[model samples]
Target: MDLQKRFDKLKKLGLCDRCLGRQFARLGYGLQNYERGAILKESKEIHKNIFSQENIPQDISPKDDCFLCRGFFNKLDKYEKMVIAALTNYEFNNLLIGTRFPQNIKDKEKEIWEVCGDQYIEPIKTEFNRLLGKRVLKRLDVTVEFNNPDITVLVDLTKDKVELQISSVFIYGQYNKYSRNLPQTEWRYKNQYSESIQEIVQAPFVEASKAKEGKFHGAGREDIDVRCFGKREFVLELVAPKKRSIALKKLQKQVNMIQDKVEIFNLDFTVKDKKKELKGKRANKIYRALAVLSKGIEEKDFKKLKQIVGTIKQDTPQRVSHKRAKLTRKREIYKIDYDKLTSKKIDLTIKAEAGAYIKELISGDEGRTRPSVSQILGCEAKCKRLDVLDIEK
Candidate 1:
């Protein structure tokens, strides 16, 4: 049917601006259906005025009702103001607006579409998002980002109500814990430090780097009892960061001063583009573990075990079987060196693949692990102190 015929049918059903423009949603870019419908409605009015002398019958009435959007289109200004108020404290460049309507609203939209044979009506979410997004861009001077946006502004338009969603910041960096007894991330308690690892790392970055919040991501995590002696590869994803190109060396120094136990290395700016590659990259790690023999053992026994350092074997540690499915894994021992800390204690240095269980390798886990320190020496061995020595890309 012609636009006039469609308009006439819609007007009989009492359509709102948001609902009216939604019928031709695909025809425009950067404008809401309500605005589009209103423009078309005005054009029809003008045309009617120009041809009023011809005595042609008008098909559609001036007032219209939209089955899909109801009258919500006229309330765009109110929704925009609410969004602006919600975003007062946040600083962001790119944003995405997501609209959520109540189940009843969505059902009404769907019912309208079904009755109209799903011909021209746009989704309620699309219309709301477009209108609100345009208003926000105009007022805030911020661009809309579809992929990896700095902020995600969510609008929930359900039962004449609106809600907003704020996106989080992502920061990428490597951190090394130099001492034990410090949690890898943050320690939270009701009376004690309730802050997360991200909170601790974000403060300095926000101040020194002038960025937003920071999210800490590491290749793997170590136990709270284990200390990271070398570089622990990580990426601190900063969410909606106001600044980039941070002075990593200086930031490292400052972070260390705050907590001498934690050290950051290989700090650099990473964009959303590189996140996939960063997550996929594999790196090697070295660890130094203080091993304690359950019984007295000869120095010659330790030397004999070093002979099999380069061998690869299957290992399955029992301690982690609960979280991890039982599976045989091939791991290689690249290098091994030991220093006699005492007659019953020794410091063992090991270079292995990224996922090798260093503590398990020393303890043997009751023979569940092969080529382990306990199995090698024919004496039960246990790890007293574990530390990551190095991380290499």
Candidate 2:
């Protein structure tokens, strides 16, 4: 049968325009289900059965319950008010609306579609999203965002409740650590309190953004005793921020107050994807170290050090094996150069692949790594001071 015939046939069983019009949701563009249903009901194309105003059926009345939605459309005002109240405390630019209908409501939708032969019909979820989105925009003056919305309001029609989910805010920057005493994240050493790079960089941002919590993600980390001399990239993700407006310059100044330990620069707002990039990044590293040798330095030692090129197979260092699994890894050493400062002390520069253990490479780590400085030179080698000079892009 044609659309008018189908509408006339379905009208015999009670349905509201919001519910009845939804069956033909995809047939018309830029028009809501209620408008479509009202048009169909009053159209001369469909024959109407006449009953006096006093004898009209209760199911056909405008205020009657919807078979498909169970009065959900009639409760839009209540749902909208609940969502608005839930969003009053949050600051956001764009918004999205989600709904969870009861199982019986969904079953009714399926049954209706099956009886109507499922032609040009949109899902109930889509209609609810658009309807709630329009209402929220009209009231809150906020635009709808399908992707990466600042906040999402969830309406649970099953329980007659509303919930809100706030997206994380990402900020990107480069930082330098002047103190070898600080770790990249918080550290608890015995009873003494030690500072960390994460605390220094992210603590102020949490307070400034009025967020519940914050996490720092670095491109790479330096050891507690090794200083990061150059710009080290990082991202700070703030969760459920109440204050979206932030002045990065002022926050940077606040973060840099502990200049004696660490500093941050080139800071700016970034996106959530930055965290993935940092996690997947494997940039080469340049390091400078002061090495103390058991024997006096010789001219031939420099040549042997230069021979420490190509792939070096290494097992996890003993110092960190307690926390890390014992596994063998192959890492490349691009180049090795050194300058003698004393008979037993020398400055060494190394360019290597990411994750190469410089300290273990110098000490040989009790035969855990092959072709190390100590193994090649036949003496014990120890790194006294180390600094990361550069990280390749």
What C-alpha lDDT do the candidate models reach, one value each?
0.67, 0.81
lDDT by residue (tens digit), candidate 1, 222-250: 77678876666666766555454466678
- Candidate 2 has a TM-score of 0.90
Q: Which stretches of candidate 2 lie over 4 Å from their true place?
A: 1-5, 28-32, 42-64, 187-193
Number of backbone collisions per candidate, in order?
22, 0
- TM-score of each model, in listed order: 0.70, 0.90
Best-performing candidate as measured by TM-score: 2
Please write out the lDDT profile of model 2 over residues 1-393, one tens digit for every residue.
Answer: 466667666676677776766777666456657655666666545433221233222344444356676777777788889999999888899998999988887887788766656676777777887788789889999899889999988999888889889998999998888887877876434234456788778888899888998888999788888998778899989999987888899989977875567888898888999998988899899999999999986887667898788999899998889988889999999988898898789899999999999998898998998989999888999999999999887
- Candidate 1 stretches with Cα past 4 Å from truth are 1-70, 101-125, 187-216, 236-251, 269-283, 290-302, 310-330, 339-347, 378-385
lDDT of 1: 0.67
